[model samples]
Every structure is written in C-alpha cells, then in structure tokens.
Target: MPPHDHHHPILATQGLSHRFKPSGRGLHDITLSIPRGQFVVLAGPNGSGKSTLLRHFNGLLTPRAGTVWLDGVPVAADPARARRMVGLVFQDAESQIVGETVRDDIAFGPENLCWSCDAVDAAVRAAMDQLGLTHLADESPHLLSGGERRRLAIAGVLAMGPEVVMLDEPFANLDYPGIREVLRQVVAMHGQGRTILLAAHDLEKVVGHAQRLIIMDKGRIAADGPVVDVLPLVEQYDVRLPCQARLGMSVTSWLN
Candidate 1:
C-alpha cells in the first residue's frame, strides 16, 4: 500500500517568497504542505517560478520571506540537516555528475557524508540495483544516455538515503523510450514511499505519474490540489494539458 497521511510532515512552506535581482520573479504568499510520501508536480508556463519554489524545499534557495520546513526541521535557519534528507536533482544531468567514472559519481554523496569505504560500496550497489543501473557501474557517466545519466544523478542522491527527492525538469533531454524509463524509476521511488517533488514541462510524461499538482503563474501559485482537481485547468489557464487529460476534459465535460 502507498504511504498515507500518518507519515508526518516531510516538507512544508509558510508564506514563502523569492525575488530575482531588483525585480522579483518567483512565488509569493506561498503556504503549502507536502505530506510525507506524496508525488507532487510543479507546473506552469515558461516564466513560472516552479523551479524557484522547489529550491526552498531543500534550501538550495534561501527562504525569501517566510519559512521552509523539511522533515519537521526549519530550513531557513539550519539547512544542513534538511539538505541531507531532501536531495535535489537539477534539470541538467551533465552539470551534476562530478566524477568521470560511474562508480565515482555514485560514491560522491556517501563520501561527502564521510562514510567508510565498505559502507560507500554497499550504498552504491544498493542504489544501482534500485535504479536498475548495476550494468553501468564502472562506465563513465558522461558517456551514458540522457535517461541513464538521470538515473545516475538520482542514484547519487539515493546513496545519501534522503527521504524527499526533488527533481527539476527531469525529462528535458530524453527520447520516448528514455522518458518512459525515467518515469518508471520515479514511479518506483514514489511507490517505495519516498516523497517526490517534480518540476516538469512535458506534462504528458508526468500526468499519470504524479499524485498532486501545484500550478504557478507569474510567480504565484494559481492552483494547488490533487492531480484530479488541478490537471483539468490546463485548458482553463490557456495552457497545454497532457494529451490524456485534454482528451478526458473534452469527453467528460465535467472536467472543464
């Protein structure tokens, strides 16, 4: 069974806001709760602050005004603990992999956590098997396909044993099969009860895969609700909806 409400608060935000330079370009008055084990998607147009909002969950971007909580720990004051439990995977796969070899890349996180050699090896192996990357264990990460590279990046975070995984546009450079493969890994992780916060544009890829949706417009949350409630807004917002959702809306009338 999937994890339910009893798991406690994995990530939460209160009156959160962000600004860029002299001009503010992110969300404001943002109060949200991401219960443990929820698969949440951040969606909006090109200029939306979806990515900026996600950064607060793990303290990648500091809280602009209010507060951010992760695993019940305040993120604004001391971000280290939350950072360990809430891992972030950037949109670009190449930018994250620091090491040349896949083994080195996978071991990087544990090494940062100061794990012993034996423990690091075990963590890497477990992460590889979990993400179905045991075969690419010794190869160079730069040589892997886009999807494989994504898995590798995620594997590095898993080595840290984080409770929440934040992915920013994970489907950016993937082919159809690669998209399917990466989505499968994400679904599997969510199934295993790890909280997932995804910022994505390829709505089709994340439509059926996500459980919750947070829609942003002009740096503010336009709508936030269960996937069933918010997904149909694609057309209402004059934005593109997933193919399946658009069809459902057209046929079901009530969805509109």
Candidate 2:
C-alpha cells in the first residue's frame, strides 16, 4: 500500500518452517536475510534443508509455518511478482529444457510474462549473448553438452530479468569443465550486481566466489556470517571445508 523500500534486503525469511508430510525432514524456524547484490553460498549435508530453503525464495514451495519476503513485501501477497523477481535454476538442467530450441527456451519466461514480441526477442538475445549461447540459438537444447545445457537453463532464467538468482546444487553431476563454465557465468551474474544464493553440498567449487557462507543443519541455520567467519564452522556441521581451507590456505576462485 505504501511506497516500496528500495533498501530492503533482496530476500528475507522469518521463522520459516516446512515439513514433508510424513518425514518431518524439512526446514525449521529458519530466519535470514540476503542483501541486494550479495553472493551467498549455502552449504550442508544431504537432506540438510538447503533445497527447501531455496524453494521458498521464489514461491516454488509454500512454508508450512513462516513468511517469505521479497523486497520487503510478503511473497504470498504477490506470488507472480516474487517469481519474476527471483529466478531459480534447478539442479537438473535437463528438466528445465521444455522448448524445442535454445532460443525458444530462453524466451519462454518473458513470453509468459506477456512481454511484447520485440521485447522477448531482445531479452532472449541479450541473455544468450551474456551466456555465450548466441551461436546455439537455433540448436536443440537436448543436443547440447552438459555445460551448455546448464548455461541454457541459466539463460532462460536470465531472460526473465530477475533481480535475484538462486541456484540449487548447480554444480551437481557436472564434470570439471561443466562446473567451471557454470561457475564463470555465476560469477559474471553477481558481478553485474544481481543477488546470488547458491546451495551446494560441495562448497569447494563456489565458496571462494561467495561473500557469505551459510550452513544448514536439520533445517535450522547452524551458522551464518562472512565467508571467512562461517566457513570454518562448516566442518562442525558435517560440511567439509574447502580443500584449500582445510590446508590452512586462502580459498581461491575456481575460475583461477
């Protein structure tokens, strides 16, 4: 009802909780805030509620008992707006490819948002160019390599022009080169001043790229702070410290 506060955290959750009907293995009383344009790495063991927390960001999943806010407004108040503001790239790249070709895939979101045809085309072109997919615009997504497919998935999300990008286990199942490719794109996106929340079981690949590190355990935030501060606590919560960190060395970007 009032004017929007531009200074609000890009994403915030208050007492967020969700439970899988029978398993009871979901987020619990999780509370956090991610400042605009900050890159954060979320790490935890399998089933530590990392993915569930990410789902709450873009209205992909409703919290059983809590509130999600996007830009100081409750997500439930305008789910479509929340979704548009926060783009999520799933772990499985194949599952996101619905269009017959790369261009079609990238244009899907903007088209659904009812953007003009010209606008959609422009957005698709920009997204493709940013991710080095312009040459493959006409190619089939199914025909691309693992890294290309992942980049295609990200391009699709980027076309929508989300202010916040959330990636769930993006490096999962990706080979060395695939991981590096995706990592570069992720870093570039953050450099362009978009908020980044990446959840990973293996922090070795992305920890260095993040300014903050959050470790989740049993659906609760076990630790949260600057990467240099929270990183040392990861191993205490079952997350392995990055190889370099384990050796008492500074963490460096995978891109290096």
- Model 2: CA > 4 A from native: 1-5
Model 1: pairs clashing at backbone N, Cα or C within 3 Å: 27-219
Q: Give the TM-score (vs. native) of candidate 1.
A: 0.91
**TM-score of model 2 vs. true structure:** 0.97
Tell me the lDDT of model 1 at 218.
84
Candidate 2's error at 246, in angstroms? 1.1
**Candidate 1 overall lDDT versus native:** 0.81
List the candidates' TM-scores in order: 0.91, 0.97
lDDT of 2 at 32: 96
Candidate 2 clash pair list? none
Worst 10 residues of 1 by lDDT: 247-256
Cα error, residue 132 of model 1, in Å, equals 2.1
Over 4 Å off in model 1, which ranges? 1-7, 249-256
lDDT of each: 0.81, 0.92
